[model samples]
Target chain A: DVKVTQSSRYLVKRTGEKVFLECVQDMDHENMFWYRQDPGLGLRLIYFSYDVKMKEKGDIPEGYSVSREKKERFSLILESASTNQTSMYLCASILGGRNTGELFFGEGSRLTVL
Target chain B: AQSVTQLDSHVSVSEGTPVLLRCNYSSSYSPSLFWYVQHPNKGLQLLLKYTSAATLVKGINGFEAEFKKSETSFHLTKPSAHMSDAAEYFCVVRFSGNTPLVFGKGTRLSVIA
Candidate 1:
Protein backbone atom coordinates (compact mmCIF):
# COMPACT_ATOMS: atom_id res chain seq x y z
CA ASP A 1 0.00 0.00 0.00
CA VAL A 2 1.38 3.41 -0.97
CA LYS A 3 1.19 6.03 1.74
CA VAL A 4 1.10 9.75 1.12
CA THR A 5 1.25 11.58 4.41
CA GLN A 6 0.38 15.20 4.87
CA SER A 7 2.05 17.14 7.69
CA SER A 8 -1.12 18.97 8.74
CA ARG A 9 -4.74 17.93 8.40
CA TYR A 10 -6.01 21.35 9.35
CA LEU A 11 -4.50 24.79 9.86
CA VAL A 12 -5.67 28.31 10.67
CA LYS A 13 -3.68 31.32 9.56
CA ARG A 14 -4.20 35.05 9.56
CA THR A 15 -3.92 37.19 6.45
CA GLY A 16 -0.34 38.03 5.48
CA GLU A 17 1.02 35.07 7.44
CA LYS A 18 3.25 32.60 5.67
CA VAL A 19 1.83 29.10 5.47
CA PHE A 20 3.39 25.80 4.60
CA LEU A 21 1.78 22.43 3.91
CA GLU A 22 4.12 19.51 3.80
CA CYS A 23 3.62 16.19 2.02
CA VAL A 24 5.67 13.02 1.98
CA GLN A 25 5.21 9.88 -0.07
CA ASP A 26 6.90 6.62 0.79
CA MET A 27 6.87 5.15 -2.74
CA ASP A 28 9.85 7.14 -4.07
CA HIS A 29 7.64 8.36 -6.88
CA GLU A 30 9.36 10.62 -9.34
CA ASN A 31 6.52 13.16 -9.59
CA MET A 32 4.62 15.10 -6.92
CA PHE A 33 1.78 17.59 -7.18
CA TRP A 34 -0.08 20.22 -5.18
CA TYR A 35 -3.74 20.92 -5.80
CA ARG A 36 -6.31 23.25 -4.28
CA GLN A 37 -9.84 21.91 -4.02
CA ASP A 38 -12.97 23.95 -3.52
CA PRO A 39 -16.70 23.47 -3.87
CA GLY A 40 -17.73 22.99 -7.51
CA LEU A 41 -14.19 23.67 -8.69
CA GLY A 42 -12.99 20.11 -8.21
CA LEU A 43 -9.20 20.05 -7.95
CA ARG A 44 -7.06 22.69 -9.63
CA LEU A 45 -3.36 22.01 -9.88
CA ILE A 46 -1.19 24.61 -8.20
CA TYR A 47 2.21 23.22 -8.97
CA PHE A 48 3.89 19.95 -9.85
CA SER A 49 7.45 18.75 -9.48
CA TYR A 50 8.87 16.07 -11.73
CA ASP A 51 12.22 15.91 -9.97
CA VAL A 52 14.16 17.59 -7.20
CA LYS A 53 14.43 21.34 -7.83
CA MET A 54 12.27 21.09 -10.97
CA LYS A 55 8.80 22.67 -10.81
CA GLU A 56 6.08 23.64 -13.23
CA LYS A 57 3.14 25.97 -12.74
CA GLY A 58 -0.33 24.52 -13.13
CA ASP A 59 -3.73 26.00 -13.82
CA ILE A 60 -3.86 28.00 -10.59
CA PRO A 61 -0.36 28.95 -9.47
CA GLU A 62 -0.80 32.50 -8.23
CA GLY A 63 0.12 33.15 -4.56
CA TYR A 64 1.57 29.66 -4.25
CA SER A 65 4.97 28.07 -4.60
CA VAL A 66 6.33 24.56 -4.09
CA SER A 67 9.59 22.98 -2.98
CA ARG A 68 10.96 19.52 -3.66
CA GLU A 69 14.43 19.48 -2.20
CA LYS A 70 14.25 15.72 -1.68
CA LYS A 71 12.56 12.82 -3.46
CA GLU A 72 10.40 11.70 -0.56
CA ARG A 73 8.95 15.08 0.35
CA PHE A 74 7.13 17.95 -1.36
CA SER A 75 6.02 21.17 0.26
CA LEU A 76 3.53 23.86 -0.68
CA ILE A 77 4.19 27.36 0.55
CA LEU A 78 2.03 30.42 0.51
CA GLU A 79 4.22 33.51 0.84
CA SER A 80 1.35 35.57 2.28
CA ALA A 81 -1.86 33.78 3.05
CA SER A 82 -5.11 35.49 2.19
CA THR A 83 -8.77 34.77 2.69
CA ASN A 84 -9.09 33.67 -0.90
CA GLN A 85 -6.42 31.06 -0.33
CA THR A 86 -8.52 29.27 2.28
CA SER A 87 -9.29 25.84 0.89
CA MET A 88 -8.47 22.18 1.08
CA TYR A 89 -4.99 21.36 -0.22
CA LEU A 90 -4.20 17.94 -1.61
CA CYS A 91 -0.87 16.35 -2.42
CA ALA A 92 -0.42 13.52 -4.86
CA SER A 93 2.30 11.51 -6.58
CA ILE A 94 2.88 9.16 -9.48
CA LEU A 95 5.53 6.48 -9.91
CA GLY A 96 6.61 6.80 -13.54
CA GLY A 97 8.16 9.73 -15.33
CA ARG A 98 4.97 10.59 -17.16
CA ASN A 99 2.70 12.97 -15.28
CA THR A 100 -0.49 11.36 -16.59
CA GLY A 101 -0.18 8.18 -14.57
CA GLU A 102 -2.75 7.24 -11.93
CA LEU A 103 -2.20 9.44 -8.90
CA PHE A 104 -1.86 8.38 -5.29
CA PHE A 105 -3.20 11.10 -3.03
CA GLY A 106 -2.74 12.13 0.57
CA GLU A 107 -5.41 12.92 3.10
CA GLY A 108 -5.82 16.61 2.27
CA SER A 109 -4.85 19.55 4.46
CA ARG A 110 -7.68 22.00 5.02
CA LEU A 111 -6.61 25.63 5.54
CA THR A 112 -8.58 28.51 6.93
CA VAL A 113 -7.32 32.05 6.37
CA LEU A 114 -8.72 34.82 8.50
CA ALA B 1 -7.65 22.19 -25.86
CA GLN B 2 -8.69 19.29 -23.60
CA SER B 3 -11.37 19.22 -20.91
CA VAL B 4 -13.89 16.98 -19.17
CA THR B 5 -17.40 17.70 -17.92
CA GLN B 6 -19.63 16.13 -15.32
CA LEU B 7 -23.25 16.63 -16.24
CA ASP B 8 -24.79 16.76 -12.78
CA SER B 9 -23.70 18.72 -9.78
CA HIS B 10 -25.70 16.44 -7.50
CA VAL B 11 -27.36 13.05 -7.82
CA SER B 12 -29.65 11.21 -5.41
CA VAL B 13 -30.72 7.57 -5.39
CA SER B 14 -32.19 5.16 -2.88
CA GLU B 15 -30.32 2.11 -1.73
CA GLY B 16 -30.70 -0.87 -4.10
CA THR B 17 -31.57 1.43 -6.98
CA PRO B 18 -29.54 2.02 -10.08
CA VAL B 19 -26.95 4.76 -10.21
CA LEU B 20 -25.72 6.79 -13.15
CA LEU B 21 -23.18 9.59 -13.21
CA ARG B 22 -22.73 11.20 -16.58
CA CYS B 23 -19.40 12.52 -17.89
CA ASN B 24 -18.22 13.83 -21.27
CA TYR B 25 -15.01 15.18 -22.69
CA SER B 26 -13.91 17.49 -25.46
CA SER B 27 -12.65 16.07 -28.72
CA SER B 28 -9.24 14.47 -28.73
CA TYR B 29 -7.82 11.84 -31.09
CA SER B 30 -6.97 9.29 -28.44
CA PRO B 31 -7.49 10.35 -24.84
CA SER B 32 -7.22 8.61 -21.52
CA LEU B 33 -10.29 8.98 -19.35
CA PHE B 34 -10.59 8.19 -15.67
CA TRP B 35 -13.24 8.17 -12.99
CA TYR B 36 -12.22 9.09 -9.43
CA VAL B 37 -14.31 9.09 -6.28
CA GLN B 38 -13.68 11.21 -3.23
CA HIS B 39 -15.37 10.11 -0.04
CA PRO B 40 -16.10 12.57 2.70
CA ASN B 41 -12.94 13.68 4.50
CA LYS B 42 -10.88 11.25 2.45
CA GLY B 43 -8.56 11.52 -0.51
CA LEU B 44 -9.70 10.75 -4.02
CA GLN B 45 -9.57 7.15 -5.22
CA LEU B 46 -9.40 5.88 -8.74
CA LEU B 47 -12.60 4.05 -9.65
CA LEU B 48 -11.76 3.12 -13.22
CA LYS B 49 -9.74 4.15 -16.26
CA TYR B 50 -10.25 3.90 -20.00
CA THR B 51 -7.01 3.98 -21.96
CA SER B 52 -8.46 3.14 -25.38
CA ALA B 53 -8.91 -0.45 -24.37
CA ALA B 54 -12.24 -2.25 -24.07
CA THR B 55 -15.18 0.10 -24.27
CA LEU B 56 -16.71 -1.19 -21.04
CA VAL B 57 -14.50 -0.84 -17.96
CA LYS B 58 -15.34 -2.34 -14.60
CA GLY B 59 -14.01 -0.83 -11.39
CA ILE B 60 -13.99 -1.53 -7.70
CA ASN B 61 -17.08 -1.53 -5.49
CA GLY B 62 -19.28 -2.68 -8.36
CA PHE B 63 -18.77 0.50 -10.37
CA GLU B 64 -18.45 0.53 -14.16
CA ALA B 65 -18.18 3.06 -16.97
CA GLU B 66 -18.52 2.81 -20.72
CA PHE B 67 -16.53 4.74 -23.27
CA LYS B 68 -18.40 6.01 -26.31
CA LYS B 69 -16.33 7.50 -29.04
CA SER B 70 -19.24 8.77 -31.09
CA GLU B 71 -20.62 10.81 -28.21
CA THR B 72 -17.27 11.39 -26.56
CA SER B 73 -18.76 10.25 -23.25
CA PHE B 74 -17.53 8.16 -20.35
CA HIS B 75 -20.38 7.85 -17.88
CA LEU B 76 -20.14 5.88 -14.64
CA THR B 77 -22.79 3.40 -13.64
CA LYS B 78 -23.60 0.89 -10.92
CA PRO B 79 -26.35 -1.68 -10.74
CA SER B 80 -27.28 -1.23 -7.08
CA ALA B 81 -26.68 1.83 -5.00
CA HIS B 82 -25.10 1.37 -1.59
CA MET B 83 -25.01 3.83 1.27
CA SER B 84 -21.25 3.83 1.10
CA ASP B 85 -21.41 4.93 -2.52
CA ALA B 86 -22.23 8.46 -1.50
CA ALA B 87 -19.31 10.60 -2.58
CA GLU B 88 -18.13 13.12 -5.11
CA TYR B 89 -17.22 11.74 -8.54
CA PHE B 90 -14.78 13.42 -10.87
CA CYS B 91 -14.28 12.77 -14.57
CA VAL B 92 -10.71 13.30 -15.73
CA VAL B 93 -9.19 13.49 -19.20
CA ARG B 94 -5.62 13.31 -20.41
CA PHE B 95 -5.19 14.44 -23.98
CA SER B 96 -1.97 12.56 -24.54
CA GLY B 97 1.21 11.30 -22.92
CA ASN B 98 2.58 13.97 -20.60
CA THR B 99 -0.31 16.41 -20.57
CA PRO B 100 -1.84 16.96 -17.15
CA LEU B 101 -5.25 15.52 -16.46
CA VAL B 102 -8.18 17.86 -16.83
CA PHE B 103 -10.89 17.49 -14.20
CA GLY B 104 -14.56 18.34 -14.25
CA LYS B 105 -16.59 20.03 -11.53
CA GLY B 106 -17.45 16.92 -9.55
CA THR B 107 -20.91 15.46 -9.08
CA ARG B 108 -21.89 14.75 -5.49
CA LEU B 109 -23.86 11.53 -5.08
CA SER B 110 -26.32 11.15 -2.25
CA VAL B 111 -27.68 7.78 -1.22
CA ILE B 112 -30.97 7.46 0.57
CA ALA B 113 -32.38 4.67 2.62
Candidate 2:
Protein backbone atom coordinates (compact mmCIF):
# COMPACT_ATOMS: atom_id res chain seq x y z
CA ASP A 1 0.00 0.00 0.00
CA VAL A 2 1.16 3.53 -0.71
CA LYS A 3 1.79 5.59 2.37
CA VAL A 4 2.14 9.34 2.67
CA THR A 5 3.36 10.37 6.09
CA GLN A 6 3.13 13.82 7.57
CA SER A 7 5.69 14.67 10.23
CA SER A 8 3.31 16.58 12.45
CA ARG A 9 -0.35 15.83 13.04
CA TYR A 10 -0.95 18.95 15.14
CA LEU A 11 1.01 22.05 16.11
CA VAL A 12 0.58 25.47 17.64
CA LYS A 13 2.59 28.45 16.57
CA ARG A 14 2.81 32.09 17.55
CA THR A 15 2.18 34.82 15.03
CA GLY A 16 5.30 35.87 13.11
CA GLU A 17 6.97 32.53 13.85
CA LYS A 18 8.25 30.44 11.00
CA VAL A 19 6.39 27.17 10.52
CA PHE A 20 7.26 24.07 8.59
CA LEU A 21 5.19 21.06 7.73
CA GLU A 22 7.04 18.04 6.41
CA CYS A 23 5.71 15.27 4.22
CA VAL A 24 7.20 12.06 2.94
CA GLN A 25 5.83 9.43 0.60
CA ASP A 26 7.19 5.90 0.35
CA MET A 27 5.73 5.08 -3.06
CA ASP A 28 8.44 6.73 -5.08
CA HIS A 29 6.00 9.12 -6.67
CA GLU A 30 7.26 12.02 -8.74
CA ASN A 31 4.68 14.65 -7.94
CA MET A 32 4.04 16.15 -4.51
CA PHE A 33 1.62 18.85 -3.44
CA TRP A 34 0.68 21.04 -0.47
CA TYR A 35 -2.88 22.20 0.21
CA ARG A 36 -4.59 24.12 2.98
CA GLN A 37 -8.15 23.34 4.01
CA ASP A 38 -10.58 25.96 5.25
CA PRO A 39 -14.30 25.79 5.86
CA GLY A 40 -16.48 26.94 2.94
CA LEU A 41 -13.33 27.51 0.89
CA GLY A 42 -12.42 23.85 0.41
CA LEU A 43 -8.83 22.76 -0.12
CA ARG A 44 -6.69 25.24 -1.97
CA LEU A 45 -3.38 24.24 -3.45
CA ILE A 46 -0.41 26.12 -2.07
CA TYR A 47 2.45 24.64 -4.07
CA PHE A 48 3.47 21.52 -5.93
CA SER A 49 6.69 19.91 -6.99
CA TYR A 50 6.81 17.71 -10.05
CA ASP A 51 10.43 16.78 -9.59
CA VAL A 52 13.33 17.43 -7.32
CA LYS A 53 14.23 21.13 -7.34
CA MET A 54 11.28 22.05 -9.51
CA LYS A 55 8.20 23.71 -8.02
CA GLU A 56 5.10 25.55 -9.16
CA LYS A 57 2.74 27.94 -7.45
CA GLY A 58 -0.89 26.93 -7.11
CA ASP A 59 -4.14 28.82 -6.56
CA ILE A 60 -3.34 29.97 -3.00
CA PRO A 61 0.42 30.25 -2.84
CA GLU A 62 0.61 33.55 -1.04
CA GLY A 63 2.42 33.51 2.35
CA TYR A 64 3.63 30.00 1.63
CA SER A 65 6.55 28.32 -0.06
CA VAL A 66 7.66 24.74 -0.64
CA SER A 67 10.88 22.76 -0.85
CA ARG A 68 11.61 19.51 -2.63
CA GLU A 69 15.32 18.90 -2.28
CA LYS A 70 14.86 15.16 -2.61
CA LYS A 71 12.40 12.76 -4.20
CA GLU A 72 10.16 11.18 -1.56
CA ARG A 73 9.96 14.26 0.60
CA PHE A 74 8.25 17.61 0.30
CA SER A 75 8.04 20.41 2.80
CA LEU A 76 5.71 23.38 3.19
CA ILE A 77 7.01 26.58 4.70
CA LEU A 78 5.11 29.45 6.26
CA GLU A 79 7.64 32.24 6.46
CA SER A 80 5.73 34.17 9.08
CA ALA A 81 2.72 32.43 10.48
CA SER A 82 -0.39 34.51 11.20
CA THR A 83 -3.74 33.86 12.79
CA ASN A 84 -5.42 33.69 9.38
CA GLN A 85 -2.98 30.96 8.37
CA THR A 86 -4.34 28.57 10.94
CA SER A 87 -5.80 25.61 9.11
CA MET A 88 -5.34 21.98 8.25
CA TYR A 89 -2.55 21.28 5.83
CA LEU A 90 -2.51 18.27 3.58
CA CYS A 91 0.27 16.66 1.57
CA ALA A 92 -0.23 14.43 -1.41
CA SER A 93 1.81 12.55 -3.95
CA ILE A 94 1.08 11.09 -7.36
CA LEU A 95 2.96 8.78 -9.64
CA GLY A 96 3.82 10.53 -12.87
CA GLY A 97 2.66 8.25 -15.61
CA ARG A 98 0.74 8.54 -18.80
CA ASN A 99 -2.89 9.28 -17.90
CA THR A 100 -2.35 8.64 -14.19
CA GLY A 101 -3.76 11.37 -11.96
CA GLU A 102 -4.70 9.66 -8.74
CA LEU A 103 -3.28 11.49 -5.73
CA PHE A 104 -2.27 9.64 -2.57
CA PHE A 105 -2.67 11.91 0.43
CA GLY A 106 -1.12 12.07 3.88
CA GLU A 107 -3.03 12.13 7.15
CA GLY A 108 -2.82 15.98 7.23
CA SER A 109 -1.28 18.38 9.73
CA ARG A 110 -3.53 20.73 11.66
CA LEU A 111 -1.81 23.98 12.64
CA THR A 112 -3.10 26.66 14.95
CA VAL A 113 -1.57 30.13 14.76
CA LEU A 114 -1.99 32.35 17.81
CA ALA B 1 -7.68 27.31 -17.34
CA GLN B 2 -10.07 25.02 -15.49
CA SER B 3 -12.41 25.44 -12.51
CA VAL B 4 -14.95 23.37 -10.56
CA THR B 5 -18.15 24.39 -8.80
CA GLN B 6 -20.13 22.31 -6.35
CA LEU B 7 -23.68 23.61 -6.52
CA ASP B 8 -24.79 22.63 -3.02
CA SER B 9 -22.88 23.46 0.10
CA HIS B 10 -24.61 20.85 2.24
CA VAL B 11 -26.90 17.86 1.85
CA SER B 12 -28.65 15.88 4.54
CA VAL B 13 -30.15 12.41 4.08
CA SER B 14 -31.40 9.57 6.23
CA GLU B 15 -29.42 6.40 6.38
CA GLY B 16 -30.47 4.00 3.60
CA THR B 17 -31.77 6.90 1.49
CA PRO B 18 -30.32 8.06 -1.77
CA VAL B 19 -27.47 10.56 -1.98
CA LEU B 20 -26.64 13.14 -4.61
CA LEU B 21 -23.98 15.84 -4.79
CA ARG B 22 -24.05 18.23 -7.72
CA CYS B 23 -20.88 19.50 -9.42
CA ASN B 24 -20.09 21.46 -12.58
CA TYR B 25 -16.90 22.57 -14.25
CA SER B 26 -15.49 24.90 -16.88
CA SER B 27 -12.56 23.93 -19.05
CA SER B 28 -11.22 25.00 -22.40
CA TYR B 29 -10.85 21.42 -23.52
CA SER B 30 -11.88 17.94 -22.57
CA PRO B 31 -11.08 17.66 -18.88
CA SER B 32 -10.21 15.01 -16.35
CA LEU B 33 -12.63 15.13 -13.47
CA PHE B 34 -12.45 13.50 -10.04
CA TRP B 35 -14.49 13.23 -6.86
CA TYR B 36 -12.76 13.04 -3.49
CA VAL B 37 -14.06 12.58 0.03
CA GLN B 38 -12.52 14.09 3.16
CA HIS B 39 -13.66 12.93 6.53
CA PRO B 40 -13.32 15.27 9.49
CA ASN B 41 -9.64 15.87 10.27
CA LYS B 42 -8.52 13.51 7.53
CA GLY B 43 -6.93 14.06 4.16
CA LEU B 44 -8.81 13.85 0.90
CA GLN B 45 -9.45 10.43 -0.58
CA LEU B 46 -10.21 9.83 -4.22
CA LEU B 47 -13.65 8.31 -4.69
CA LEU B 48 -13.83 8.23 -8.48
CA LYS B 49 -12.50 9.76 -11.65
CA TYR B 50 -13.83 10.44 -15.16
CA THR B 51 -11.25 10.85 -17.88
CA SER B 52 -13.46 10.89 -20.95
CA ALA B 53 -13.67 7.15 -20.79
CA ALA B 54 -17.04 5.69 -19.75
CA THR B 55 -19.39 8.55 -18.96
CA LEU B 56 -20.70 6.74 -15.92
CA VAL B 57 -17.94 5.82 -13.46
CA LYS B 58 -18.23 3.61 -10.43
CA GLY B 59 -16.11 4.29 -7.40
CA ILE B 60 -15.24 2.77 -4.06
CA ASN B 61 -17.69 2.45 -1.18
CA GLY B 62 -20.66 2.09 -3.55
CA PHE B 63 -20.36 5.59 -4.97
CA GLU B 64 -20.61 6.61 -8.61
CA ALA B 65 -20.55 9.66 -10.83
CA GLU B 66 -21.78 10.38 -14.32
CA PHE B 67 -19.93 12.76 -16.57
CA LYS B 68 -22.08 14.88 -18.84
CA LYS B 69 -20.12 16.88 -21.33
CA SER B 70 -23.14 18.74 -22.67
CA GLU B 71 -23.96 20.08 -19.24
CA THR B 72 -20.33 20.22 -18.11
CA SER B 73 -21.42 18.38 -15.01
CA PHE B 74 -19.95 15.46 -13.08
CA HIS B 75 -22.29 14.79 -10.23
CA LEU B 76 -21.66 12.12 -7.59
CA THR B 77 -24.37 9.71 -6.51
CA LYS B 78 -24.99 6.68 -4.39
CA PRO B 79 -27.84 4.24 -4.17
CA SER B 80 -28.11 4.51 -0.40
CA ALA B 81 -26.55 6.69 2.22
CA HIS B 82 -24.57 5.14 5.04
CA MET B 83 -23.60 6.72 8.32
CA SER B 84 -19.97 6.30 7.30
CA ASP B 85 -20.65 8.26 4.12
CA ALA B 86 -21.08 11.50 5.99
CA ALA B 87 -18.16 13.68 4.98
CA GLU B 88 -17.06 16.56 2.79
CA TYR B 89 -17.00 15.84 -0.93
CA PHE B 90 -14.95 17.80 -3.39
CA CYS B 91 -15.23 17.89 -7.16
CA VAL B 92 -11.86 18.40 -8.79
CA VAL B 93 -10.60 18.94 -12.34
CA ARG B 94 -7.31 19.05 -14.19
CA PHE B 95 -7.61 20.77 -17.52
CA SER B 96 -4.63 19.46 -19.46
CA GLY B 97 -1.85 16.98 -18.94
CA ASN B 98 0.29 17.31 -15.82
CA THR B 99 -1.58 20.30 -14.45
CA PRO B 100 -2.54 20.61 -10.79
CA LEU B 101 -6.13 19.94 -9.86
CA VAL B 102 -8.65 22.71 -9.29
CA PHE B 103 -11.09 21.94 -6.49
CA GLY B 104 -14.64 23.09 -5.86
CA LYS B 105 -15.93 24.51 -2.60
CA GLY B 106 -16.85 21.05 -1.28
CA THR B 107 -20.33 19.77 -0.34
CA ARG B 108 -20.80 18.44 3.14
CA LEU B 109 -22.96 15.34 3.47
CA SER B 110 -24.73 14.61 6.72
CA VAL B 111 -26.34 11.26 7.35
CA ILE B 112 -29.16 11.12 9.86
CA ALA B 113 -30.30 8.03 11.65
lDDT of 1 by residue, B1-113 (tens): 56788999999999999999999999988888899999998789999998877999999999999999999999999999999999999998877765567789999999999
Candidate 1 is scored at a TM of: 0.93
**How high is the lDDT of residue B107 in model 2?**
99
Check candidate 2 and list the clashing pairs.
Answer: none
Tens digits of per-residue lDDT for model 2, A1-114: 879999999999999999989999998888889998888998899999888999999988999999999999999999999999999999988766447668888998999999
List DockQ for all candidates. 0.57, 0.65
- Could you give the fnat of all candidates in order? 0.58, 0.58
Give each model a TM-score.
0.93, 0.94
Distance from true location, Cα of A40 in model 2, Å: 1.0
Positional deviation of residue B29's Cα in model 1 after best superposition, in angstroms: 2.8
